[model samples]
Target: MSRDEIIDITNKFLVEEFEVDTEVVQAEANLKDSLDLDSLDYVDLVVIIESNFGIKLESKDFTDVNTFNDLYDLIGSKLHAIA
Candidate 1:
């Protein structure tokens, strides 16, 4: 999948699963701050990534993922690795 598709699907999941506002899911937006995600939310996020993208993520993998764009790149890289 292309980066745009990854962003779109990730945004949809954030909106639908986390109940985040569509406008808050911007590329530069801070994932934790913008979505008010807590530690429990991270667990759900991991599940979402695995179920949707078939990518198993570790907490360390998200250490540098401050923004949605970072997440897009991480997911993209994992997809590429699998492909």
Candidate 2:
């Protein structure tokens, strides 16, 4: 998938699964802060990502993920690895 597609789908699920406003799901937005995700929310996020993107994301996978763009890159890399 292209970067645009990744961003599109990520935004969709973030809105649907997390109840985040679409406006808040910007590329530069801080993932945890923008989504208001805590520890349990992180677990739920892992599940949501796997279900939506078909990639299993471990907790450590998010160590360097700060913004939504970072997440898009992470997911894109994992998808590339699997492909």
Candidate 3:
């Protein structure tokens, strides 16, 4: 999927699950810090991504994904590899 598509899906999930404003879920936003996402939320997010994108994201895969842009890159790469 394209970066814009990934961001749109991610932002939609965040809006529905976390009640976050889609406008605030920008590429530069920090997923953990800026969003204040807890561990369980992270797990749920991973599950959502896996189910929707068909990519198995291990905990280690998230080690370096601190920001939304980081996550976008990770998911984008996973989508590319799978395709």
Candidate 4:
């Protein structure tokens, strides 16, 4: 999938599943703050990402993900690796 497709899918799921406002789901937004995600939320995030992109992600994969763009980049890299 293209980068745009990844962004679209990520935003759609964030808004739908996590109940995040569409306006707060921008690339520069802080993932934890925007999603109001706690530790347990990280597990949910991992599941959501795998189900959405068909790529396996460990909690460690999110260690560097401070912003939404970081998460997008991580997913992009994983998808590229799988391809």
lDDT of 1 by residue, 14-54 (tens): 99998977999999988899989999999999999989999
TM-score of each: 0.97, 0.95, 0.90, 0.96
Instruction: lDDT winner between 2 and 4, please give it.
Output: 4
lDDT of 4 at 14: 89
TM-score of 4: 0.96
lDDT of 4: 0.93
The sequence of per-residue lDDT tens digits that candidate 3 reaches over residues 5-78 is 99888778777888877777878878897678889988988998898788989999999998899998999999
Report every candidate's CA lDDT: 0.93, 0.91, 0.86, 0.93
TM-score, cand. 3 vs. native: 0.90
- Model 4 lDDT per residue over 27-57, tens place: 9989999999989988988999999899999
Supply candidate 2's per-residue lDDT for 78: 94
Worst 10 residues of 2 by lDDT: 51-60
List clashing residue pairs in candidate 1. none
TM-score of 1: 0.97
